[model samples]
Target: MDYEISLETLLQHLGEEEPFPYGSVTPPIVQTSLFTARTLRERNTQQGRNEFGYTYTRVDNPTVRLVEQKIAALEGTEDALCFGSGMAAIASAFLTFTESGAHVICVATAYTPTRMLLESLLVRYGVQVTFVSGECIEEFAEAILPNTRLIYLESPSSLYFRLQDLRAVSQLARAHGIITMCDNSWATPIFQNPHALGIDIVLHSASKFLGGHSDLLAGVVAGRKEHLEPVRRTRELLGGVLDPLAGWLLLRGLRTLSLRMERAHKSGLKVAEWLAAQPQAAKVHHPGLPTHPQHALAQAQMRGYSSLFSFETHPIQEEQAYAFADRLRLFRFGCSWGGYESLLLGWAQTESDANGKASWLFRIYVGLENPDDLIRDLQGAIDALTP
Candidate 1:
């Protein structure tokens, strides 16, 4: 048996096994709040254990634990912990590691909610943070405070698609005894392995790729057993642990992740290349593009690309962006991606309009569709946008 089996193979069998003789290939969802032990002594004995112990759903559940174990193995991590949402996993990792006075260095173009959590909530609690471009390793080194306790990264960053040097940053963090974490949702394990680059913690918005459908809201954090144990304990204490049904769904979604991701990569590149060649397009950002500043780094680190990417166009006005978006028939307007449906999000009202944080740029998630048809659709949309 090869430990390094194909992702398709791993997806099929990762967490679907049953413990009993029911002969059910699919793992049953243990939907109860609590479990009963055969005896008090037996319960006490089981409580002393780790994976096999399952006293409560919030503390741990058999179904959810199986998902954790499966993801841990897939990520080449010692253990994993699931959460109600991606933010829960992210916030818990911070809370578990950093105290009130600890410092963190983060990317400026991070996920908006994560930025809010760091700036508003964490700063209010005495956890100071520094934001940087995250393009060069030296930026991270320059931002490090004496009390810096953690470093967070999101490669091919949210809006700008800025790539970070994970190995360099991780090495710097390790030298200073600071914990390193990256949101791995964008790359997934199929594309990049942050752990292999010496990152201590890896986070995911399972609601996107891991779930492989737009229906579920879930998250997972993977890392060494020592680092993740505290996060697991904190999750148990905070009551943000994943439920059994979501775990089962996630397990089911991952069954076709490898296949879905391959198609996504192919379609993504085709779309990006098409966009790059368009006269109306101002810029297209994707790691798969050779024109991307960090394309070489991405090639060195990742196995494949995903469909989620962004682009810009010469709009007559902000309204043109929305007009272009509305003209498209195949791409539905949606907030999140990694599902089977092609989606697009139009730019929001500008910061000048409402003193908002900032306006959104055009973002697209290329679903499994014909590349030529999608290109045709995009061309018509762009044509309609010009005044």
Candidate 2:
């Protein structure tokens, strides 16, 4: 089914085996490393279904396959594969498409490790990458080369949270016979469906929003069967498959994705707006806000926004920023977000504009807590910054 179907049905009931696997509400984790056949002839037959059947857990497992199906349904793709971590899925996709001398066009602000992968590992293999701002279609169009095999994008990308026009980029890639992949972790499928916009592949760091409870590390790659077939083979060879237990936990996480996304969306906007209006916040970088430069484009593409966003303080000292972060009781200082608890991360050194005015920047993740409580927690911290 397509994205038009209700997400509640897709997440709760889709891909569920009839009779509920011994009538249990949840599917059992088929944790065995091997699925054996009684006889050599049956073994050959089972092995023959290697790509589709479960002869081995590393190649495929029942629990992981179930998670893949639900993810495919959520992404509105024909098939999907789960990986041990987000980088595993990303690396597999890159390795699947790139040979020596292949070129890739990537957004400048993609996840840091991804950028590192492109700059370090991929370059070592003779593959070249061009990083673009991704603010306009022409930037991508101009960067394309004869050897360009892929265009990698991360809309509402890390930290600064810049956005790209997925439909535009997808069209550009298709016209050039190049594959397109997008990291959709920021605006989970509940808020944004990248595949529906014609992207060749949709990727997710399921460790974030999809896992919901911060208890699992999983990555997802979804696309047409033809596109994902080679990626699946690469996954098998690379040995980056998701564990069965993590698959089961991911299943648990998917059930509440819609509700959590809704909560995050509302609470996030409330907090972002409040921060934007504050005297200390020089700027807030949330697309949901009308003050955002690309608010119209964001509204055109995404149905709703998620909870992670960043803001800049009005030229605060590094120690002052640290003091503010330390003062907050409710917001935990951590790198990753998208779970039940609120998180904050500040750059200790202030960034300077071209004119050399320094300003401290910070990212906030509004969790499943009451927005008012989180706002109060933030207010207490900002109040601490006062003389």
Candidate 3:
């Protein structure tokens, strides 16, 4: 089927094809490590071409290919590669384009592991990295060195939810013969299409949203086939290929992605609004809110918002933050989000230079629950803090 269909229709129809043997509704999991070729001539022919006749699971599997195709289609890219985890995908993508002495310009508030990959490991190999606040387009332009080979961005950045002008940054990079990559996990393909905004490559922690159920860990990098070929080779060499079972689980998650995102989007905005009105919340950091610093840019670039966001708490002690989290009944105290259950996590500022109003930061992920119930639960948690 052509991928020009609506997203809702595309999700259901993209991965559907005639199942072999018995013609099942869903594709059968091709779970073998290796496949046998009928003849030497056939095997030689398959090896010579870039066709989909699989010889080994590490290189490619039918089940995994199906998920990759669906994600590529969703991202409006020519191809995609899947990985065992988000970091693996990210690492492979970076290794594909970067080399010794090459420099990278990365957003200041990117995913923690990604920053570490550049600072800790890549630096040892002589790859220089410059971290800049991508909120200003000029910061990226100024950060570019003669050796700069790539620009890494994460809009609505990790904890602060700060946005970058993707088009502006991408343009600046392309003019300088540099590649651009973005971690689009926060706003899944449902809400944002970075490639459409001129990013060279788009990435996702499929475990968060594409998996949707927290039952699987997978990652994806989607872009033109030329850009992904090296990343795919890096994945094969690194041996971080996603298993077939995880691929199947991801397919199940993608089937209902649109539905789940819609509910989460509405509930997230409602909760963000409620948090803003509360006395305990010093600042709310959701792009959907009018009070957000980049609300105009977000509306211009994104179709909708995701469920994950953070808020600064009014001057509260470390113990008070713990007590508030403990009092919550419905929201689970967890690290990850984009699952069926809501989660709340708190971070306390130990440094004296911390913003006085931002002594504690609370990150919230609204789930499939009713917004009113979640709000009441939060209100009770806050009330408990005072008592």
Candidate 4:
């Protein structure tokens, strides 16, 4: 029988309907630490699956496994591993693949904690990293060495929002026999499939789009079994397994992912377009924008854009950014986005000088609000900022 299902069908199957044959309509959270086997042989088999043989929730949980299977279906991968948080998933994937003295190339603006892992923790253990702008395919190619084991990327990077040419980067990584990993949180599988573009591993902070409500903290990595095994081992060993309740919440979030993403795509474009009209807005960066440097590439690879995007303004200072942010009533000033409520974050203090010239800018995570109301809020906030 053919296994392929349309995206909508996949969403319903993978997100809502658990493969578990339990009689309950809602999946009963498998909140047990141990499963009782009826016989010694059965116990032996199950034990082998667990600690000395399957005895703990840390190693495996039916609830978490269901979430992994669903994400795997959405991401078009062979298998997946789940983590307690986004950084935990990232750490498991890298720590499993990389050893002391392994050389890696990465886009400069990957998630800050991811960068910290490479530069701080991994470096102490002998890993060497080269941060490249990833402006051209050749940039990564030039950075690779004989010892380079992996190429890391975060397209439409978090704060900076730089778009990497995934096809070009994946081709380069494959040519050199190096594995490719990308943070796919921004676009989610509903908007873009990194696997279809030839990426080897796709990572997500399911806390963001996959969890959808900003309620649960979770992460997932999807790829071939070879890559997933190491991640699973690392997660199991490191005790980063996601809880059953969080897994259930993420499953609930995944149900409306298609609808939420579609609305985000349209609303995000409208917001980006409207932001382009503001006088204080120096430049707006979004893949959906015709003026974005990588618009063509984004359009080619992504099915649609999401509400998360960044905008840089002329005022120059974290204070100005925060001032504008504080004035907004609808857009809450905080981190951790992808909810019914919109969020705004000011530039990191490291982004500015003592003299107050803003080196970086604010990012916006638009929510399911009326576009006209959002614009009016932005208009009032911009007007509030004074010299």
lDDT of 3: 0.88
Query: Could you tell me the lDDT of residue 158 within candidate 4?
Result: 78
Off by over 4 Å in 1: 2-4, 15-21, 44-52, 348-360
Q: Write the per-residue lDDT of candidate 1 for residues 1-387, one digit (tens) a residue.
A: 556677567656665544443887778888888877767777776654333566778888888888888788778888889998899999888889888999999999888999999999989889999999898888898999999999999986786677888999999999999999999898888788899999999999999988988889899899998998788889988888888899889988877777888888999999999888877666788999998989999998889999889876553466566678888988998789888889887664244343223334678899878878888899888775543
| Model 3 stretches astray by more than 4 angstroms | 1-4, 48-52, 350-358, 384-387
* Model 2 lDDT-worst window of ten: 348-357
Candidate 2: regions farther than 4 A off: 1-5, 46-52, 348-357
Of 1 and 3, the candidate ranking higher by lDDT: 3
Model 3: weakest 10-residue lDDT segment is: 349-358
Higher-ranked by TM-score: 1 or 3: 3
For model 4 the TM-score comes to 0.92
Q: Give Cα distance to truth, residue 113, candidate 1, Å.
A: 0.4
**Candidate 4's error at 156, in angstroms?**
1.4
- Worst lDDT 10-window in candidate 1: 349-358
Per-residue error (Å), model 2, residue 79: 0.8
Superposition TM-score, candidate 1 onto the true structure: 0.93
- Global lDDT scores for all candidate models: 0.84, 0.90, 0.88, 0.85
Expressed as tens digits, the lDDT of each residue in 1-387 for candidate 2 is: 455657687678887748666699989988889876666676687654443455888888988988999999888899999999999999999999999999999999999999999999999999999999999999999999999999999988999889999999999899999999999999999888899999999999999999999999999999999999999999999999999999999999999999999999999999999998888888899999999899999999999999999998776556677789888989988988789999998773355655544577789999999999999888888964442
Best by lDDT: 2
